[model samples]
Target: MRATVIRAPHDIRVEEVADAVVREPADAVVRVLRACICGSDLWAYRGESARQPGQRIGHEFLGVVEGTGADVTGFAPGDLVVAPFVWSDGTCEYCAEGLQTSCPRGGFWGSAGSDGGQGEAVRVPFADGTLVKLPADAASDDRLLTGLLALSDVLGTGHHAAVGAGVAPGSTVAVVGDGAVGLCGVLAARRLGADRIIALGRHTARTDIARLFGATDVVAARGEEAVAAVREMTGGHGAQAVIEAVGTEQSMRTAVGIARDGGAIGYVGVPHGSGTGLDLSVMFDRNIALRGGVAPVRAYIPELLPDVLDGTIDPSPVFDLAVPLGGVPGGYKAMDERTALKVLVTP
Candidate 1:
């Protein structure tokens, strides 16, 4: 089998690796059918996140069951399923509270000694808890299949941002990024019945998708200028709910600046750099609430999956580029260069 490996900054390759197989009673080997790159992966690709040479990369995928260990019973060979980026034991206390990311025995894919999603197959741990069964008919529909794939990460993360920010009927919401997750945030706000969605981004191509996803306004500015634009649009009140999809000092500052007094900010972006751009004094003075972190996407899948299957929300448009397993290096380059929004990998 061949899988993607990070050799160094700006270098990704598809290399032969050991085959995936069930290694534990709770394990299952899945023949990957669809996989995609994530925005967070770029941190390591750009050398901002450390990785050993030859470390496996990628952590979102859906596939068909190939084999299952004796203890696994929820799925059988030929069952279609999706694996969250992280694997967790469904029986854990955190999982029961809908926080599977904190499951005691949970672990992320592509970590050392684990198989990556950007490969022909993967050996999934805690199989029944980690893999969600998908309808078999999804395999024959490319668009629907792609939408289902989004449930593995970005869509769920965006929904988590909306939930965290307390988006509700007739609420005014603002999203702070235009990447795939940000665009998905727009869709999520719409799904939650937000009447006004302000998307802050400079890229016209991405903002266009934001509009399609129900962004009522687009603020193509940065820093305080963007904050003023949003405030003015809201009659100097700012948005009631803000989704910070870009994990950066400046973006977080912008989110804080544009949130209305007593409003909430849901931050789903994976924080990077040395500073967090958070000011406790301002939040305290304004009575603003801060929520959200690494999204527990595994817990969101069940609630969001039905909408994806029913065509109520289509996240597939975020996947602007497609690549075969052999073309993964180019896929990474395209994403790093900002030429692609997201890359769909067909193994």
Candidate 2:
């Protein structure tokens, strides 16, 4: 089998690796059908996130069950399923509370000694808990499969941002960033019934998708200028709910600046750099609430899967580029160069 491996900064390759197989009673081997690159993966690609010379990469995928260990009963061969970026034991207290990311035995894919999603197949641990069964018909529908693939990460993360920010009927929401997750945040705010969605981004193509996803307004500015635009649009009140999907000091500050007094900010962008630029004094004085972190996407899958299947929300548009397993290096380059929003990998 061949899988993507990070040789160094700006060096991603598809190399032959050991085959995936069930290694534990709670394990399952899945032949990947659809996989995609994540924005977070760029950290390693850019050398911002450390990785060994040959570490596996990628973390979103859906596939058909090739085999399952004896103790795994929730899935069987030929079942279509999606695996969350992180695997968790469904029985953990954290999982029961819908925080599978904190499960005691949970682990992320592509970590050392683990198989990555950007491969032909993967050996999944805690199979029943980590894999969500998809409708058999989804396997034959490319569009539906792409939408289902978003549930493995971005869609669920965006939904988490909405839920964390308390988006509700008629609420005014602002989404920071215009990347795939940010665009998905716009869709999520719409799904939650937000009447006004303000998307902050500079990219024309991405903002166009934001509009299609229900962004009532697009602020193409950045820094305090963007904050002023959002505030003015809201009559100096700012948005009631803000989804901070870009993990950066400036973006975080923009989220805080554009949130109405007593409003909430749901931040799901994987924090990078030295400081978060969070000011406790301002939040305290304004009674603003801060929520969200690494999204527990595994928990949100069940809630959002129905909408994807029914075509109520289509996240597939975020996948602007498609690549075969052999073209993964170019896929990474395209994303790194900002030429692609998201890359769909067909193995």
Candidate 3:
């Protein structure tokens, strides 16, 4: 079998590796149909996140079950499913309370907890607890389900960002960054009932996608100018909710600086050190709420899965390019260099 590995920053290679197998009774082995590169993957690929030689990289996937343990009843070999980026033992205390990302038994592949998703097959532990069954029409739904795949992480990450920011009905929300996660934030904010949605992006292509996702306004400002534009859009009071989808310092600053007093900031951008100290006096005096971290995607998937099935929300547009596993390095480079908003890799 072959798996994707980041030999070093700016260098990704698809190397032959040992095959993955079902070693645990609670595990399921999946034959991946498509696995997309994520900004999070870029973190490790770019030397921003810690990783070792031969670490299997990749986390978002859409695939068919090749085998499952006896204890798993919700699925079988040949069934297509969407697994959340975070793999958790559903019976844990955190999982029971709807915080799968924090599950004590949860395993985040390609990261510290477990293996990764960029390969021929994946051994998903706690199969019954983590993978979601897609519609019976999964064959036809495959190509159209990229957004659902995105939901397994980025889309869900975006939704979590908006919710963390405290977006509400009739409130104006602003999003920083125009990447797949940020564009998805626009969609999530609208779904959460934000009436006026603003997206801050410098790229025309990305900003266009943001508008399509329900951004009522687009600000093509960079750095502090973007922050000022967001404030000006909300009548100088700033947005009631600001979603920070870019992990860089500039975008993080834009998210916090553009938020209104008493408002909230939801940040879910893989945190490449963008999270810093805010003016304590300003935040404390204004009563602003700050919330976000790794998104609890598994907890939110059940609610969002139906929306994808019913066609109410389509996140597939984020996948502007798709490639085979062997071409995954190009996929990573395209995304890291901003040549593509999101790249899908089929393994």
Candidate 4:
């Protein structure tokens, strides 16, 4: 089997590796049909996040079950499935509360000795709890494939931002950033019934998709200018909820500044930069509620899967570029260079 390995910053290679196989009774092996590079993956790609030489990378994928351990049930060979970026045991207390990302027995893909997602296959732990079965016909269509693949991570993360920010019917929401996750946030805010969606971004391509996904306004401004634009749209009151998708200091400040006093700010971007960390004094003074972390994607996957299958929400536009498995390095470069919003890989 071939898999992506991050040897160092700006160095991603697809090379032959040992095949993924089930090693525990609760595990299953999935033959990946589609995989993708996540914005979070760029942290290591840029060397901002530490990486070991030859470390397996990536964590968004959907595939067909090739084999399962004895203890795994409700899934079998040939079943089409999607695995959340994090693997969790459904029986845990945190999982019971719809917070699978915090499950004590859970861990992320490409870490803790698990196979990475951007590979031909993966050994999925907590098989019954982590893999969501899809209709066998689901993978046959290009649009559906893109949507389902989004469900594996980005869409679910965006949904988390909307939910975390307390988006509700007739609410005014602003999404910070125009990355795949940001665009997906626009879609999620609409699906959740937000009356007005403001997308803060500069890229025409991404902003275009944001509009298609349901952004009522696109503010191609940054910093205080962006903040003023959002407040102006809300009659000097800012949005009721703000989704911070970029995870940078400037983006976070923009999200906070554009959120109405006492409103919630849902952020899911992998935090980076020196000033990106939380500032308690600011939140305390404004009575702002900050909610979000690594998204509990498994919890939302089932909630959002029906919408994808029913044609109610299409997030496929995020994958603007596609490449073969061996061409993953180009995919990384495309994303890093801002030439592609997101890249999809096929085995």
Which residue pairs in candidate 1 have backbone atoms (N, alpha carbon, C) closer than 3 angstroms, thus clashing? none
Candidate 3 TM-score, C-alpha based: 0.96
RMSD of each: 0.7, 0.7, 1.5, 1.1
TM-score versus the correct structure, for each prediction:
0.99, 0.99, 0.96, 0.98
lDDT of 2: 0.95
For candidate 2, lDDT tens digit of each residue in 233-315? 99999999999998998899999999999999999999999988688899899988989988899999999999999999999
Global lDDT of each candidate: 0.93, 0.95, 0.84, 0.92
User: Residue 37's C-alpha lDDT in candidate 2?
Assistant: 95
Name the lDDT of candidate 3.
0.84
Better of 2 and 3 by TM-score: 2
Where in model 4 is the C-alpha error above 4 Å?
277-279
Top-lDDT structure, candidate number: 2
lDDT of 1 by residue, 17-94 (tens): 999999999999999999999999999899999988998999999999999999999999999999988999999899
What ranking of all candidate models by lDDT puts the best one first?
A: 2, 1, 4, 3
lDDT of 3 at 34: 76
